[model samples]
Target: MTSRVLYLFGSAAPPVHDIAAVVRTAQNRGFTVCLGLTPTATDWLDPQRTELERLTGYPVRSRYKRPGTADVWPKADVIAFAPATFNSINAWALGITQNFVVGVVAEGIGKGIPMVTMPCVNAAYAAHPQLDRSIETLRGAGIRVLYGEGGFVPNAPGQGRPPAYPWHLLLDAAEQAASTP
Candidate 1:
């Protein structure tokens, strides 16, 4: 069976070209992509979601209510949250399934599937006590949390891209997870 990789989107700033690149790279690596979109993410890349679906030939879900409606929901093997916003992170940490991304993540955790979350928020939010607690909670639960490198640096001229350490590390983790028995 083809290994599945679900991509969850969070509320990041506009222009998610970096995310698009990551998704495209994963797709090229032969992983099926299931996109779960946080509502706020729609503001940055509305049509791109549909475009991603077209490119991957997989379903892109924006809400939890529409899952399994596409006939491929139960086949997921891994779940990854990239560019995870503080709101979505807090909600996931608290078991709040207010949207498709959190709902899928909750299900993945219940099933004991490997999960990876890349948090992309401002430094202040990343340093918040609640955020730390949430990260600890996720770590205790065996979820790999890839904190933004060198603090919360939004996509800027030289800093907005994925951190050098975390990106390859997460990719390696994903490869191992996909190859697992």
Candidate 2:
């Protein structure tokens, strides 16, 4: 296919609410966007499920399909997992594939799928030390993690979400990953 497929996964973070806009932005950048979400994120966006499926031209899948079910989304050329939550990140890094989103990304590592992840976490969670280890683990596995300096910086709890979540940086890294061959 000439157009690369972008598997965009979001967690339960607040920024996931802006996914429709992000899908449009990714489309404008020439990706065929396919959106997936953590189970709670899917519940959070249930009302917009139809619209999101329409927006991305694919089913919004959270739960794993039954055995023998065919995969619906196109083969992903690159994955941009942004607004990943503390729980999702930790679970993903630890190889806990309880959720569909984390399962794909966990397998994406071995599938040779180029991937980018930007965590949307609070300062309290970011300071837990496990977050740092998880980020390093992902990086060691060739996944570009947009955390700490030059990427996403955690905000203080109760301070509200950051106005900008560095979507550009994450998308830029995704673009680069797809082109690396």
Best candidate, TM-score-wise?
Answer: 2
What TM-score do all the candidates reach, one by one? Answer: 0.80, 0.97
Query: Which runs in model 1 stand beyond 4 Å of their true positions?
Result: 1-4, 8-10, 13-15, 66-74, 148-168
Error of 1 at 118 (Å): 0.9
Clashes of each: 1, 0
What are the lDDT scores of the predictions, listed in order? 0.66, 0.92
In the range 53-134, model 1's lDDT, one tens digit per residue, is 7775666667655445655544666777766777878888999988877877877787888887777666656567898888
For every candidate in turn, the CA RMSD to the true structure comes to 3.6, 1.1
lDDT of 2 at 16: 89
Candidate 2, 1-181: lDDT as tens digits: 5898999999999888989988998899999999999989999999999999999889998988899989888899999998899998999899999999999999999999999999999999989999999999999999999998989999999765645878888889999999898
